[model samples]
Structures are given as C-alpha cells and as structure tokens.
Target: MAVALPGVVEELLSEMAAAVRESARIPDEHLLSLKFIFGASAVQALDLVDRHSVTLISSPSGRRAYQVLGSSGKTYTCLASCHYCSCPAFAFSVLRKSDSLLCKHLLAIYLSQVMGTCQELSVSDKQLTDILLMEKKQEAS
Candidate 1:
C-alpha cells in the first residue's frame, strides 16, 4: 500500500532532494562540536568516509538548506542555519532531548568536507526525479 506523507514531511523531503541535486560543496565552517560525543556511531561514521559515497548538496543561490547522501545510501536533509537534520537519529536522539548537533550522515558530511573528499556536482531536475523515484521503488519493494 502507498502511504501519503504529511505536508511538512513532504516539504522537507522535497527541499532535501532539491538540495541534494544542486549541491556544490561542504562549507569550511565547523557546524558542530569537534568532540566525539557518540561512541560507536561516531567511530563508524569515520570509517565510511569516502568522497564518492557522500554528496553534500545546497542551493547555489544562497539557500541555507543542506542535504547529505551518506555511504549507507540514505539522504539526510537539514537547514544549516538551524542545525536540523531530517533523520531518525536526529529526530529521536538529537532533538527534543539531547544537545547534539549532528546525526551520522551529517557527521559524515562534516568529515568529508574537512577531509576535502567531497565530489561537487550540479544535478539536473530529471536526475533528481530519477533518484527519488528509485528510492521510492526500493522502499516499496
């Protein structure tokens, strides 16, 4: 069965997808703390540090939104100005209870940026649509 996503969720997802399709590069500023707050996941995120695997996308016209494609094949969206990531770990573990600033995917983006391993791309609308369609198909199956 196909379930409809809420307006807010859909909006976030769309914004994330757009950002992912138009990403240039990870910024140089430190968006989160440098200390390793999370134990296993933090270490694990470091291991999955590959430029080809992760894509940091943001609008070219000064939009503050960001989306990161992690090595695990999951895309995480965030408003860089607000430091919010639309990931389960961010929603359940980071927000509303904790003071952490990043999930694994966000952390991966940060690491990739710092390590200078990010591959910049300008994705077309068709490509973005195709990627989203692929993800939906994978989820449906």
Candidate 2:
C-alpha cells in the first residue's frame, strides 16, 4: 500500500522555513543539535543548510525512502512498510500531539537520503560524483 503523502509540498516548505529561521537564530543549543545530527566538525548549525538542501535525492534503486541516524547514534530503519521514521524525534513527534510534517530526525534522514548510503554507494565514485554534479546543477539552476 502506498503511503499517502498529504500536503507534502506545503509541509516541506513550512519545515524549510522553520529550519531557516532556527538557523538564523544561531543559538548555542541549536549549533549543538546540528553537530549531533550532522556529525560535522563545524560549530555553526548554518553550515548544515547545504547538507540539508542535498538530502532530497533519490536513494539507490530509486527508492523514495531516506535514511537517518537518531540521537542514540544508531542507523534508523527505513521501513517502506511503515510510513513513520524510527528516530526518537520522529517517534516522539508522531506518538505525541504535534502537527509537524518532518521532525528534525526526518530531516536528518532526508539529508542522509540525499547524501546516499555509505554502505552501497560509498565506493561508487563515478555514480556518486555524477549525483553530486546533478545536485549542484539542480541547486544552481
């Protein structure tokens, strides 16, 4: 059964705007979250905007699924059978009362999804490079 992505565009854009606003705030706490989420050495969370932007790409095999790691430092299960993500952020958000479309965890997975899987495409330099070039062009154009 296909999971209905209702109001996906509106939700994604709303989430994007919230992320941008949070990035502009540049709170110390937010920076820590970025480091925790992205595993980047950079202190500013703003640096993640680039990474986040590229996280919407298709996974290998053309699956719509994306990947992400939870704050627990474990790989999230991209269960196609279930519409929900496994990260605490997502789990908590969904199980709780909230209207968020993409929690930070989902966004993290989105970033991971666009970045491609290390297990599969890590060595496919040619394909990875091609994908990166495509992403660059898409962003530039």
Candidate 3:
C-alpha cells in the first residue's frame, strides 16, 4: 500500500468537517470520503458523536479544550486548537509513525464541534490547568 500523506488527508477531512458545519447537511459522498480515508476511525467518530461523548470545556479565562470519552470508558484530553490528543492511537499512529493525521478521539472532537453534538461546560482557570496537568501525569505513568 502506498504511504498516505498526512497533510493532504487531514486537509480533506478538515474541509469536509467545515462543510458539514456550515451546511448542516451530510452528503453520502462526504461519508464515503471519510470512510475511504479514516476507515474505522470515521465510523468511531460518528459513534462518539452519536453517543454525545465529546465535550467542550471552557475556562473563565477564555481557554477552550475538549474531552472525548472512549468506548472503554476512558476520557482522553483533546486540544483541538493545537491538534493534540492524549490517546494511544495518536501517539502511535500520528506522532510516532506518521501514518494518520489524528486519532479517533480528535476526529470525534471535530465532528462533535461541527455537528453541535458535543456537551459544553464551564470551569475555573485553575481547574483547566489541573485537567491539563492530569493528562500529562497519566502519560508519565
């Protein structure tokens, strides 16, 4: 199989996501594009959105982040602003091997934001810092 160009693939998915957000309509061809590119991750992203497992957390200090609840019941931190996800798939596939653009968790976050399906919550700045720190700690252990 030919090696996938992460930039081109991610750009396509991002455009499709933006189109879905603006149009509020899902075309069959868009779904097909996602399936062809992201494969199982695309299906999983839709499931995460359907399950309302994506959350946008905002702090009083004007910072925003995301949390994606996995099928295993674990919540992963997703920093969409920086395209970061604290998931094993991201670590292995995206960062380590460069085989994929983002993990299912990050994809779910994008889909949730575009479709207005993600939950939202507000918190203090301190809480936001703690949340980020906790993610780092988990990675250490």
Candidate 4:
C-alpha cells in the first residue's frame, strides 16, 4: 500500500529537485568543494544513481525519513534536515571528521537528485516502524 509523503520529506524533495534542475547555474567553486569532500565516492555515486533504490518512508504520526537501498542490497537511512546518514562511512568518517559531508549512500542521493533520477516511494507506518526496528537491531549487533 502507498501513503502520502510527510511534509518535511516532501519539502526536502522539492528543494532538491529544484536545485537539480538549476544545477547548471551552480558555481564551479561549490562543485569543486563537493568533489573535494566526496572524493572518489562522487564518481562512484553516479553509477549507483537509480530512482527505484531510494524511498521515502513515514510513520503514522507523520515523522519522515529516507532509505537508500544500495546495489549491494544494504539499506541506509538518511534523516531529514540534519542530513545525517546511518552508514558506517558516515559514522566513522563524516561524523569523526567535520571536513566530510556525505557517505556514498548520501552522495548517491544527492547525485540522484541532481540527475533527476530519484524515485520516492511512500510506505506504510508499520513498514517504517519495522525498518527502524531492523536498523536498531543491526546497530546492536
């Protein structure tokens, strides 16, 4: 079953889509900065850009989050507003070092947005809850 996207996720997607559509006008310096931070992952992210891999899941109370399923079949969560990702690279690198901005999963999301290839699917509240539980369990192990 399908559900409506939460306000925050919807807004974020709209903003990213607009930015992607207008990316041509973005400054070279900004592009260089992104390149510097994301490194080789920037190039790798492009290959993983697919609309079907990214989903927007929300709780019954309207809390929203993003899930990116990698080509490896692993799932990563991207939280709203903060841009934080639940990936090992994000935790070990981005969080440990302030210089970095994104993991491959997050980079893939950004690249997918810029390429106008991000597909958003809205899932049920129970699905969201189950995803969260699974994430927590994975972390614990």
Instruction: Give residue 13's lDDT in candidate 4 (0 to 100).
Output: 44
lDDT of 3 by residue, 1-141 (tens): 223336755676667767777887667787888788888999998999899999999998889889999999999998887788899999899899988877999888877766778899999999999999999999999
User: Order of candidates by lDDT, top first?
Assistant: 3, 4, 1, 2
- Superposition error at 7 for model 2 (Å): 2.5
lDDT of 2 by residue, 70-90 (tens): 444444444433456554555
What TM-score would each prediction reach against the true structure?
0.52, 0.36, 0.85, 0.67
Task: Give the better candidate number (1 or 3) by lDDT.
Answer: 3
Model 4, 91-124: lDDT tens digits are 8887887656567777777556655567766678
Instruction: Please give the distance, in angstroms, between residue 78's alpha carbon in candidate 1 and its true position after superposition.
Output: 3.2
| Model 1 regions more than 4 Å off | 1-36, 123-141
| lDDT, candidate 3, at 68 | 90
lDDT of each: 0.52, 0.43, 0.85, 0.67
Query: Which portions of model 3 show Cα errors greater than 4 Å?
Result: 1-24
The stretch of ten residues in a row with the least summed lDDT in candidate 3 is 1-10
